[model samples]
Target: MRKEIHLEHSSLKYPLPEQFVQELSEELAFMNEYPSGGSYKTLSAKLAEYTDIAPDCILPANGSDEVIESITRAFGNRLILIPIPTFSQYEVSAERNGLNKKFVPCLEGHNYRLVYCEEDLKKASLIWICNPNNPTGSSIPREEIKRVLDIAPGIVAVDECNYEYLGESVVDLIEQYPNLAISRSFSKNFGLAGLRLGFAVSSSKNIVEIARYGQHFRVNKMAERAGIKVLKYLDYFQNIWQEIARTRDFFIAGLKGLNIMVLPSKTNFVLVDFTTEEKARKIWNFLRGEKVFTVAGWEQEFSGLDNQYLRFTISNQEEMSFVLELLKRFPENTS
Candidate 1:
C-alpha cells in the first residue's frame, strides 16, 4: 500500500503503534453502554498525576474545541478578546455562544507580536491566547502571559494544543490565578485525532463552572480507553516531539536555502512565505496538483493575515523528502 501522507491539522506524522491499536480494538466489546464514570474517574486521576493538578481541577471534554465552547458558554456575558491569526475555534465558539468578540491584531510585519495597550487590555472579559500560536507558531513568553493574567480582570484562557511539543505550560498557574484556563489536546501529541480526546485544567471552582455549562457526558468509552492506554506509554509519545523538531529544522534549513522566508516555530508546522498573494496561490495550486494539500495563509481561520504564507505540518523526513522535491520547483515556471 502506498503511504498516504497528510500535512494538515498537525497530527503526528508517525504511524500508530500496533500494540496500542489492538488494545483499543479489544475495547470494542463494550459499545452497548454509556461510558462509565469509573473510566473517567481513573483517567482524571491519571491526568491529575500527569498535569500535577488534583482530579477535581481537571475537566475532560470531547476535545479541546468542546472545552473551549463550554468555557465560552459559561462566560458568555464577558467580551471576548483574541489575537488575530490564531485557531479560529475561539472566534467560532464565541459566535456560537453569542459572546461579543474583539480581535487584537498581531503587530504589523513578520513578527506578529501580540500587543495591546492598557485600555485595550482592560476592555471586556475573556482573552484567548494560543501559545506557539497556530500558523505562525510564534510564542509568548511566560512573563508576558503572567502579565496578561495579572492585568486582565476577566478569565485569561490559553489554547495549549501544542504544549507537549515545547513543554511551555501555564497549567501550573491555575492554582495561583483562578481566572486562567489551559486547554490541551491529545490529538496532536498522542496521534489520537480520530479518537478526538482532549481536556482542560483550571481551579476546581472553574472546573465546576465548566461542568455546569458543558455537556453531561463529554467523553466516550473508546476515547477514554484510548487516552488511558496512550498514557501508559507516555515516554514514546514524548519522544515524538524531539523527532518532529529535528525534521522541522531540517526542512526549514532546506526552505531557507531556497530563499523562501520562513518563520521560527516550536510547533510541528512552519509557515512559508512566497512574498506575494499571487505567488503563494501558484504554490498552493502546484502542491494541490501534486496531490498534496497545505493550509493557505489567506484562509478565514488565519483571518486573512498572511496572504502569501502556507501552513505545512512537518511530517517525517521520508514524507518531507517527497514534499521538498516538489517544493524545489515552486519558483521555476511560476516566475
Candidate 2:
C-alpha cells in the first residue's frame, strides 16, 4: 500500500528533536503530581526568556485554542469585529461565549488584507486578527495591526500561531498596547501539535485577566516539560523554519508552473484557486483517491468563500514533488 500523505493540517513536516523523548521520559515519573496552574511558572519563565518579556506577561495554556476561548470568555462581552476568510476558531469562540459578531468581507480583491472601517472598530469590544492567516496563508503588516490597536475600544487579539514560519511578529507591541494579546503555539515549529502546548503573550495585567478563565492545572506535566525542553533548542528549530519557508515557496512555484493560481503565502500552506468550485472539487477528489489529502476552502467555515479553493500544506521536497506530479496528471477542464 502507498503511504498516506496528510497535507490537511498546516503542521510542520519535520520531526521533533531526539532530546524531546528523553525529556518526556523523565516527566513520566511525575505524572502523579498536579502541574502548576495554566500560567505555569517554570514554563512562563522559559517563554519569557525566549520572548524577552516579563514572566508575569505570559499565560501558558493547553494550546492556542484554549487561549482563544479564554480571550473570549474574559472580554468578549460586546460585538467582535472579525475579518472573514480567516481562522474559524475566532468565530467559534465568539459564538460559544454569546458575543455578537460582525463579519467584514476582507480578503477578496484586497490582496488578503484586513479591511474594516473605524466605525466598526469603535463599536467592537474584541477583535481577532490571525497573522499569516489560516487557509489563505496571507499576512497583514504590523502597521495595520497598530492602526487597529489605536481605534479599537476593547481587547485586540492577534493569533500568531504560524509566526515561526512567517518570521514576523507584533509581540513588541504588547508593551505599548495593554489591550494587545498575542497567542502562539509550539505545535507547528516544534512539531508538538499532539502535545497541545501554546501560550498567550501580553501585558502583565492582561495575562492575569486572561488566566482567570483557565482551569487549574490545565496544562499537562508532559506537555509543560516538552515546551520547556524545546525552548533550549531554538537554534535547531530556526534552521528548520527557514527550510520550511523555502519549501513552501518552491511548492507555490510548482503549482504556478502548472498554470494553477496560488495566493502568495508566508505560512506553510498555499491557497490554490481552481477557477471554479467544480474544478476544485474534482482535483480534491482526485488527490484523495491517490492517498493524498488537503483542506478544502469551504471546510474552513469562516472564509465565506464560494470558489471552493483548496489549501495545500507544504511538506518535504520529495512529497511536494510527488504532489506536483499528481497535479500534472490531473485532466484539467475535462468533463
Q: What lDDT does the true structure give each of the candidates?
A: 0.82, 0.86
Residues 168-199, model 2: lDDT tens digits: 88988887898899999988888889989889
For model 1 the TM-score comes to 0.95
Q: For each candidate, give its TM-score against the true structure.
A: 0.95, 0.96
Residue 86 C-alpha lDDT in model 1: 79
Distance from true location, Cα of 185 in model 2, Å: 0.7
Candidate 1, residues 1-335, lDDT tens digits: the string is 55445686688878787889888889999878787552278888878898888998888788888888988887657688888877888889888777798888874666867675567568757888889888788887898888888888888888898998778899889889989988889988989888888898988888888777665677988998887788887878778789899999999898887777888888999988788988889888888778788888667766536688888999888888788888887765223
Which portions of model 2 miss their true places by more than 4 Å? 333-335
